[model samples]
Each structure stands twice: as structure tokens, then as C-alpha cells.
Target: MLPSDCPISPLPRSAMLYCEIYAEVKPGLFSSEAKSQSSDRTMDLGLAEDHFSRPVDSFVASDIEQLKQAIEECKRLILELPEHSEKQKDTVVKLIHLRLKLQELKDPEEDEPNLRILLEHRFSKEKSKSVKQTCDKCSAIIWGLIQTWYTCTGCYYRCHSKCMNLITKPCVRSKVSHQSEYELNICPETGLDKQDYRCAECRTPVSLRGVPSEARQCDYTGQYYCSSCHWNDTGIIPARVIHNWEFEPRKVCRSSMRYLTLMISRPVLKLREINPLLFNFVEELVEIRKLRQDILLMKPYFITCKEAMEARLLLQLQDRQHFVENDDMYSLQDLIDISSGRLSCSLTEIHTTFAKHIKLDCERCQAKGFVCELCKEGDVLFPFDSHTSVCHDCSAVFHRDCYYDNSTTCPRCTRMTERKQDLPDEQDVGS
Candidate 1:
């Protein structure tokens, strides 16, 4: 400690200040050696993995909302910190960790932040130890000992769930089965290895595996189509041309304009074709952004009939089977593109010619024309109004008169009465 006698001269003022600024240990930057710093960063980010690495099924909406709130709070804290404070640096590092967790919850796409708002999240039955250590997502080396992981139950591919959205891959074939009732019955082999069939339109070598992809089979036409070729079948926008575009009219449009951009940008994605309901939701937001009221005037603006909604959902399938995963239906690529001038269609255009099947839900009291089961032979259309009555005893809804005439009491109520009659009275039991 006898440094008072030491002859070392002081450095320049700038150098001394620089050292002082850097001398304080930063949040994520743990050490001077590159290897140590790298390890430190990994550990810092791994906090999320430890907390949220549970199977997707285990997480409820509340848990997800909590994580989201935490992320926002962290951002706020960081913003309030002084620019040069070590606390500020630490908070920024925390923000990165939080963002990565949020990313795991989204579908992959281009510059657009999220693919869609996933209402129900799905996860594989398998986890880190059961699956491979390599990330199927980024194809980066991920050590299982250090990081947690997830696996696809359909393809058995191990990756971070977020990684599932990054690249185009074949569709999962585990759910396909023969449908005898299907009028159009041509199906080429669809197992993972059969990448031989060519798309009818684009002639891209297609695989039934449905990876990035092969021909999408048409059970209606007995044909297979590549994703781009199927775009013609979907009729969203005229083949990638910003100008002179003609969007084909459709009752059930699968992919959105934003989805096309993601495909072009080359992010692997695991998703099903979106149902019309979800698509219209995205479009409505677009309408609000652009102030286009035309969507309100459209015929199918509101959907009341569950049967009709199911019919539109049927249009989402390439074939009459559930997809292993739905492709990203949610994306802001069209808006992003319009803003960046990559695609045409201004926000203000009443008819951007999207051919979008915009839809709305009926008000609670407005539903009508439901077939009444009680009027079995006559098959009358029962309005949800005066015509409808729920049984007091059984809670079954039926036409009011039909229920009263056929049986004064519901069959379930009658059975319940008979059962009560057979039971001993409480007084008798006491005696």
C-alpha cells in the first residue's frame, strides 16, 4: 500500500475518464475475457428459459399476461434510469431477455413483429432431455446443459417454440386420414420422404410432407399446388405485382398479403391456413388504420350462423384434413410494405382490391333462422326470440310450444321425478 512513493505518472484526462466510465461492472457484461462474457450473457438470458421453458399447455392466459406486463415494466424502468448508470445498463440487458421470451410466443415473419394473435397456444409432449440438443429453430448450436428446449410432437423436431416460426417446412402429416365421404378423392403419397410430385401450376418439386413446401393437395379437384401456385387458387393479390393487380373474389381466403411477404423473406413457419374469422379481424384493424368504411358495407360483414362459419373454415384446408400446424394468418406485412413502398395499396384506398372476405359477429340478440329440433317433421326456422324457450328442468333449448305440447315435463325431468318417487321419504328413514 506504499503507492505514495511509486513513480508511475498519471494518464491523460480523457483516458482517465474513459477508464472510470468502463470500470463499473455492467449488468450483462461480466468479465474482460471474450469467452467469460459470452458465457455470462448466455446465463443472463437463460433466466427466461428457466421460467418459461414449461410446455405450452401448462401456461394459461393469466401467466402470459403477467409475463407481458413484466416486460413492459422492465422497459419503463430502463427508460427512467440515467443514461450512464450501471443500473440502466443492467435493465437494458434484462429487456433483451424479456424480448426473446416474447418472441417465442410469436410466429415468424418479415419486419412485422408478430404473425398473429394466437389465442390457444400448442406445444409438443416432448421436452429438452427427450429431444436433441440442437435448435431446430436457428440451426444454431444450443447446449442442453445450459439452455432449455422444446420439441415438435408432429415432426419430432427439437427447437425453441419461437424457432418453429422462422422457416418454411413441410406440413405435419400425422393427422391425415381417409375420408370416404369426400367427393373428390385423389391423394398422392404424403409421407415425409415422398418429395417427388410436382405442383400443377409452378412445377416446384412438391412433397406431401407439406414442408416449405410441396404441392398443397386439392381434395375438391384432385390436384396438388405449390404455395405460390395455390395463391392463384386463393386469389389474394395478383402475382406479386404492385401495380395492375387483380385480386380474385373468394368466400374463404387462406393466406393474407402480409403472409406472402414472409414467404418471400424466408422465415421458417409452422402454422395452419387461417380461418376467415381471424383474417377478417386483421382486415378490420387495417380498415381502422386506413379509415376504410367499405368493409362495413360488405354482405358477409357479420357472421351469425355457426354452420356458415364452419363452411368458411372448411375453405381454409388444402385437403379435408386438419393441418399439423396453422400457418401465420396474422401479419402487418401489407401495411409495412405499403409504408416501405414494396407493395401497392395505400391505407386510404376504399378498395385496395384486397378481395378480403371481411366479416363481423352478430350482436347477441340478432341471431336468427336456427333450425328447431322440436319441430322435427315441419323443420321450421326458429328465431332466437319469442320462438325460443329453454326447459326449466333439463336446460334444453327448443321451440316453446313444441316442448309444452309433446310433454308437459321434459323427459329428463320425468325421469328425475320417477327416481324421486322410488326413493324412501326422509321421515320413513328416520323412523
Candidate 2:
């Protein structure tokens, strides 16, 4: 409190009024040294007010520290006042204002690491009347018109622009790193009790018995999420595409949708190894298999042929060089393409080009072709020919009718066996 004789022309009216009220309410709140301390505090407040007028970029470490001290001073003054009193309430509001100012001064970019999830945040235009979407960081209701907010494209993580920098939670898409393989089980839901009756994402309390908060299940992850976390977003599940050959979009949680979106193009699913019967049932898959096989056969010829190399024949596969490298493994996108006949049409075009080069265009490639051993025919037959049969053991090509007539036995294998027998006899005779 200031002395009665001291001049108080420099101090603000509000500061003077506060000092008078503080002294009256709690006389012992300030000591004999209070006058000097209060003067210093008034000077600090004056400096702080001047600093607040300046831009946030101009705020130095000392300015932030001064603001923090002022905030603490406000809290201490509030604690000394009576409960529910106007003075206490006023001080509390001041403290909150000071804290907000401090937050504004601090640079969020300086504190936070670069976010790993590449969130494609879009301005939320449509508002749902039934369920209010709250910010994931602050849990404040997002008013579409009054408050400008963003929702992630893939994960659907919603937040106000003010709360975005404060977000520490990694996106559901990033969480997919924990999963080494795709979830094969269809909607493998462990009951809500298993999840402790909480959301799989935010851990917010969720209950099926409750009327307002109904738990939504993600068909992809088989985990339950609250309405905010699961937006009924649909995506093509990789497991479904591989197992059931189903490309239909199914309801999935935001995280699952994001995960599926990322995995769609990744060639990790070994379709033939996982479900071989798909080849028998799906005609497109069967055709794809045949085309891949022919591609593999043509690979050897293309590699050895100078003319094919000059033409860059293998470049015909483009991004699908994997078709020649491996036959069985396919991506979810590959399945989707197959379903639409796009992949088969593309492979057919590639196969035709490769076939043309191997059969007629290049002599080096033609020289690699097999003569029908069973028929002793002068005509050369490529393994890719429809009427030719390949030996399982020796891979020798023969005319299909002649092979079947020869009891499907490989003539090359018989000759090799006879050669081995003759070698043993010759060694015994030499000994």
C-alpha cells in the first residue's frame, strides 16, 4: 500500500483501486516493505502493458518471464482474497487473461517437433446437427461459421486452428506401423468390455447401453470407436480384397480408413500364397496368372536379345516390373484393377508386345525356342504356345498331342537317366 503523503499521479487508476482494496481486505497481506515492492510491481505492470502492445515476434525471454511473474502475482493476490468475492473473481479473470497472453507470446513451432503425419487438413464446411464435432485437442465444440477449423483428409482428426499446434497425438494412419500384416479377420471385434468401455482412439468413455454415445465398430481394425473417432467413412479393406476378392467399400473407423488408404498401393499381399482357390474362381485372376507366367518366360529372352534390349522391351511393364519379377504377390490396387478388368487389359497389351518380340521380331529370342522333342518335329515351339506342353521336371517343351500320346513322360528325362546309368557302368569297367 502507498503512503498517504506519497504522490500517486503516475500509477493507473485501476492499479491504485486494487492496492486500496487489497490493503483494506487483508491488512497483513503486505509487509512494511510493501510500498517499494508495490512500486516495483507497478513498474513491471507498466512495462508488461507496453510489451503487450508490441508484436509477438518482438517478445523476448525477459518479457515472457515478466509475464509469468505477473500471472503468479495475480494468483497469489486471488488466494489472499475471500472466496466468491468480486475481488477474487476479478483477479481470477485477470490471471486467465495473463495466461492467454503468455500463450500467445510463446512460439508453438519452437516447442514442437515436426509432425510426422502428413495431415491434409481441409476447412470443415458441413456441420452435423445431430452430433456436435469437438476439437480433438481442446474438446471445445467447433462452431462451423464462427470458428474456422480443420479436419484431416485421411484420419478425419478435427481441431480448431488454435488447437492444432498443441496436438501431440500421432494420427491413426501413423499407428499402422505397429501392424506387420493386414487384419485378415472380418470385423474382429473384441467386445467393449475388452476396450474398458472406452474409445480406441481418444479413450473417451463409451457405452452401448447408453443412448447418446453409441460405440461404432471399424470393419477394418475390428476395434470400437466413439462417434467422433469413427465418422462412418468407407474404404476398401485389403484383407477383404485378398481373402474374399471383395472390392466393395465398407464402413471403417478414421484410423482404419487412413491405414487402408496408405496400404492400397503397397504390393505386400501374396494372393496365390494366401488363397490359391481365388485363381480357380476369379477368371481375371486366372488370366493375370497366365500373363505373369508368360512375362516370366519372356523375361529370359528379353534379357538375352540385343534387338529387344535396344528397343527397351522390358520398359513395356512400366511400374509393373514386379509382374515379371514375381507372379503371386499383388497389391490391393492390383486387385481393384483386376476387378475392373483394367489390370488384365494392361497385362494383355504388355504380353502381346513381349510375345511379338520373342516370336517373330528377334532371331536371338527365336533361337531360344524349343523344338518338339516328342514329335521330333523341325518346327520350333515356344513354351507360351497354347498347343505345347512343358515338362514338369526338365522344362522341355513338346507338342501337346504328342506328349499325351507318349504317356506324358519326358523324353529328355529318359535320355538323362540312361546317360547316368551308362556313366556308372563305364566307371566300373575302367576300375
Candidate 3:
């Protein structure tokens, strides 16, 4: 490439030897252009040396270009080594096309050697690992086209099941009603719009049409409730708090501490004005208290009499008329012979009157006595002989002789039986 027409300089023998060695050692310097070689030699040597460097530069230029092309080819193959198989010729071509596109995207101002190297390294690493897109939640295959999936908005975790209740125990109503007709578009708890969210109640999409967003009632008295238990009146209370005698003395003194809500059509000021501490908070407290007192007061009657002279009083208004009945007629003669209402003395007096009224199989044997088969407690039996007698209250079989001697009733229930079936019409016999 360089011309051999410049003048040669007479230099020191050592300098001449050094110039020739530099020319031979570093061929790239001379291969680029003759002007460059001549200028360098002019500073380092005379006019004769410049002329010599020009010719030498031409010879090196061709060799250097060949070496440069070889290196570039080697770099290309290294970058495309992952898809270099003969069977993957199409892949190789595709990679080459991609490389060309990357080259086009190089920095215009700066040399893009680093950019090209980075692209080549990344492409090779991806191909070697056969990296494909997949969902982290389900590990399902993913393509670039799928933009939206069922993902937890809170954690950004994608999942297949639309609702989380598949593992957890959902709200009771949600378990009962798996697919709610009403699809909700918002989170009920937060009152925020959620297209993919589910109702905590039904575990299904909430609809605006069928299901109500808020519950009409709630199980918890003083707490916020989910939509599920709002309408359900009977909610499970903590047995520890409700049933513990130490915490609640009413439960042990009474049987239970269930608070029943009673709605009266006509709310009276007298009923409403009374402090619930003095009386209960219910509208019909006066009547309810009277009924309960009567029932408990007449428990001796219920225990002694074969027929339940005791009215079954319930705390709930709904159950008030459950056991109500018309009064039975009494014979006028029996009323005159025995002092009417004399049995209503002490509770023990009533018990004795009801016991004496019982018709025993034999006065001595006392075989025909009513007794619970399970507990041997109760009165109501007939004279069927000494061997076997049916219990009036329960299916207890007892002998006449054994009835009187057994002072203590059945250990289980402690209920005593009167040895006679109290006839149905006999309620007013001693009236």
C-alpha cells in the first residue's frame, strides 16, 4: 500500500537495526497506511528509511486484513455457538439476523464493542439454558401473549384457583353456598373495587343482583360480622364465656343463659321504662316471670302428680302457647267430700295429696307404682301383680313388695314414683 519513492537516511548502524526490528515486530503499524509509516520513520529515521517503510507497509496491509477477518469470523461463531449444530442451520441464520439487528442498534458516537459483546453473551446464555417463560405461582407454561392471570393483588402472586378457600375453611355460608348467584365486583371488607376478587361469604364472584352486600342481622351482639352470619340468628357463642359458672352465675343457678329477642307488636312504655336489672329486658317480662315462677313453684306438683298439673313455661314468647291446654272438669261430689284447693298448702302437702290419690295394686306390697325405667323416678302405675309392674313415667319394671321398702328413689334421677296410674279425669278428683 505504501509507495517506495521517499529518500533514505544514513543512520547509525544500531538505529538502522532497531528500525528494521520494529518494522518486523509490529506489522500492524505499517499495514494501515504508507503516510503513517512515512511520518513515523521521518521522525525516527532519514528520508531513505521513510522510502523503505512505505514499501514494507504495503506488504503488511494485506496480511493484517486477512487476520482481522479471521478474528471477526471467530467472534461470530463464538457468539452463535449454542445454535451451531448442523441440524440447527435455520436457528443459526435466525441468530445471525438477530445479531445484525443488534449491530444496527449500536451507539452512534462511541465504539459499540461492549454493546455487541453484551448482546452476544446474553443470547448465548439464554439459548444454553433453554430458558422459557413460566408462571412462578403454578409453574405453568407462559407465552408473551398472556397479559392477565388470576394473581393475588396484595402479593402479586398468580394462582389457578380463583378463591383461596380451596385450602382454608371458608365462612360457614360460603361452605353452604359455594356458588353465589350474586357476583361481587368489590372487596366487601375494604369496600374497594376488585374485578377478580371473591366474596368472603360465598367464595364466589359477588353479583349485584341476587345477594345483599350487607347482612340484615349479625350473630355477634357487639362485633362486626362478615356477610355470612349477619342474617343467621343462632350464632355459636364461646362456650367458655357462655357456659362457665364462675364467669356467669346465672347459667349455673338457672339452666342456660341464652338471650332471646322478642318483638312485641305494641311496645308499652311501662314495659320499656323498667330497668332491665330489676326485670328482664324482654317486652313481656312480667308475664314471663310469673309463668317461670309458677312452673318452678309447682315443680313438686309435676314430680308428684302423674299428670303434669305444672305448666311448661318457656322463656321465649314463641314457645308460650306450646303446652297450654283447657282446664279439666271436676266431680262436684269429690269437691264437697274433700276440701277443694286444700292440696295447695305447702309444696310437701301437695306432694302428699297427689301421692295418696295414687291407686296402689296392694297397700302392703305397693307393686303398682309409676317409675322411670332408666331412673326409676316418676309416678304412674297399675296393679299388674307383684312380679312385674310398668313404670308410669318411664319403662321401669318393679315388684309391689319392693316399691315401699325402697325409701331412696333411683340413684341416678332421685325421682319417686306413686304406685298408681293417675286417671286422666282424676285431675279434679280432689279439687
Candidate 4:
């Protein structure tokens, strides 16, 4: 009971056999009687499709509203799925894509103007060798083989490409004011229970139960973070650098890593005030301190001398102006340079240049130099000279051996006291 003009009748024996079986299974769909019914249903479906379809350019506020609702629905579905399951992962990926599309429709501008700090995000395909890296924003596993992600060069903030645009956290280097001080304590870990067993950065509930819930301690801040907030990144802690002079790298959270990186070049550490004994142990520190003191003493001569000014004698210390201005403060980079002997070598060169100008080249500078009072030697003696000693009372300089032999008393102070005693007393003159 196939229609006589039915396309199923191809005249081939194999085609006829297949049509006969289809006709028996359906009984009416291929017959002439059912053609009219099928035509009516097709027309109804086409009308419904036409009612829903619109031009792409016709998108309005209502479409955006619909997208928002769809995104919320997707989020709900994701929450209902089992955590860490493949189905949940797929839903999260879909949700991120939908969010990206919504953002494009809302702003259209590729670059946002309200960003606090622009980060140079460098992406890498290789996984971290030490820790299993997770997205800092989403707390999701960064599947290096399948997903592309970015790590900030300044702060070491890691996140997925999809999460990068959504990041609202400012780079640690952006807040220079807050980075002036450092936590001086060495790994002063506050117990996890005090933090309510949560990550310090994200407030994610963590535990000591499983690998996924393992909490990592930041050596700088001494706070626990989840794997997402801490990727086992290591940095030299400022406290260790200042107190112990230990430059060995230690594990820190992302925030601490960024903060330490910002503080690396800043000369905010008052090393003398923090650890005065450090100078006694670190030979480079002691030598640098002495050199800085010498530079300070030589600064006035360079300023007054016309020849030294024309030659830009202070220009040699342009990069290290703090060495002339302050004797105690040191930066992390300065400490590293001192340990490597680079700072000492550079300071020695500058010191030699300054000494040459003060003692030999400039006549005016040499005239300012002191002649030893005890020995009465014509040879010039500077306060910075190793064989010279300055009197605390009269600010006069003398040979170290001569000053010690004279009971550490200044000759100028003795003469001034005797002259005052020889003069008539003020009360007797008034009488």
C-alpha cells in the first residue's frame, strides 16, 4: 500500500525490499493518505520556527537579559553536579564561554579602562614541576595539554585565559605605599583553626583530609592558602634577608610572592635599626657601611670644589644616591649585590674617584682637609682616614697614636678651657 508515485520505488530489487519493510513498520507514512497529514504538520512547524527566528542585527536589551538568565541557569546546573567530576568540568567550561560572550555584548571594547594595574601576562604550556597549578581565580585544575593560561610576570598571579578578563585583584606592585613595611617574623604560622580552616586569600574551605584540600603555608605572611592561591612559588623573605642575611628561596603564596617582588628593589629596610649585629657578621655589610660613611664625608668637598662640580663627581653615585644620603637603610637588591661583591667593587671605584679629587686634584678641597693637632704634621688628615681620630668635645682631628698617648683629650679643648679660666669671672666683673 505504497503510493504509486512514491520516491521509495527506485526499481532496484534491494531498494524495493527496504521500502516494503518500512511500509509495514509505519503502515501509513509513505502512503498517499498520510501525505496530506504530514504536509499540514510540516507547515505548522515552519510557522513556529518563523515566529522565533530574528535577524542577528535585531538583538536588543531583551536578548542580553535572556543571556543573563541563561548564565544563571548554567551556574545552578554546575552547582548541582558532583564536585571534580568530568560533567561538572564541562559545565564550568560552558559557563565561562557564556560569560565571555555576555561581556563582549555588554562592553564591545577589548580593553577595559577601569583596570587598576596593567599586568604583562605571560602564558606557558608547561606544567609546574613542584606544585599542581590551579587557576588563581576559578580554583580549577590548569590542564596544560588542553587549556592555555596566563601567569603575571610582576606578581606571579596565575589564571585561565577566560578568567583573566574577570580578575579584579590589583597587582601587588601597584600599591607601593603598603609595601614599605615587611613582616619581620620568620614563618609565624597562625593555626589553621584560627582561620576557620579556610584559605586566607579566597576563603575557600580547606582541610587536612585529602590532596585537593591540602593547605599550603606562606613563609612570608605565615598564612595558609589553597593550591590555587599558592602554587609552591618560592621567594626570599625580607625578614630573613634583614635579620639572618639568608637569601635562600622559600615557599610563599602568590600574594607574598608579588609583594616580595615589589619590595626587592625598594630601599625601605632600615638594616641598622632592625639588626645592628648583622654588620658584625656580614663582612660585605661592614665594608659597605664604612664606604658609605667615607662617601658622606667626601660629599661636602665635591660640592664646594669648582673642578669637581664641572666634572660631575656626584654623577657616579646617581644610581646609589641613598649611599650618600643614608648610611643604614638597605634594599634587598643591595644586600644581594653586597653578597656577590658587585656593590663593594662599584663603591670602591666611586670612593677612589672621590678620594682622588679631595686629596690631590682640587686645591680648594685639599685646603678643607684637617692637619693633625697632636703631631702638628703638615700632612692633611681627613675624618675618614684610618690613622685619624676625632675628638668628641672639640671636633678636632689627630693621629690615632698621638690622641691615645695624650689620654684621649683634645689639645684645642684644653686651650679653650685654660683661656676661659684666665679671663676675669663674669660675677667679679659685674661687682
Best by lDDT: 2
Query: In candidate 2, what are the lDDT values of residues 268-365, reduced to their tens digit?
Result: 78876788888888998888888898789778887888888889989877777678798887878888999998998888988898888888888888
Query: Model 2: runs farther than 4 Å from truth?
Result: 1-57, 60-178, 208-214, 242-244, 307-311, 424-431
TM-score on alpha carbons, each prediction: 0.19, 0.63, 0.17, 0.63
Per-residue accuracy of model 1 over 1-431 as CA lDDT, tens digit each:
11122221232112222222333333323423312212122122234545446564645566556667776665545444444455555654555545545544542222233222121223342324323355644656544322344544333445554455553443232211121111112223354234347765445777767766755654223356666545433323322122212233322112222223223222121112222343343443343322222322222322444543654632332221112122232223332353354332343342332122221233331333234455654433322233556665655556777777775556556777888886778557888
Which one wins by TM-score: 1 or 4? 4
Model 4, 1-431: lDDT tens digits are 22333343332222323333334434333334432212112111111222223456755797667667766765555444444445544444444445545655654432322232344333333344334567878877664433445666556677765677677567665555554877899998888899899998888787767445778899998999888788899998888888788889999987788788878877888887888889889888889988998888888777887898899989898877788788888888899899888999999998988898888888888888788887797588887787888888876778888888886458789899988986778758888
**7-125 in candidate 3: lDDT tens per residue?**
22232112232333234323433333312212111111111222212242223444334434433443333233332233223222322333332222231112212211111111111
| lDDT head-to-head 1 vs 2, winner | 2
Q: Clash number for every model?
A: 22, 0, 22, 0
The CA lDDT of each predicted structure is 0.39, 0.70, 0.29, 0.69
Error of 1 at 187 (Å): 24
RMSD over all Cα atoms, model 2? 13.4
Which of the predicted structures, 3 or 4, would earn the higher TM-score when compared with the native?
4
User: TM-score: which is higher, 1 or 3?
Assistant: 1
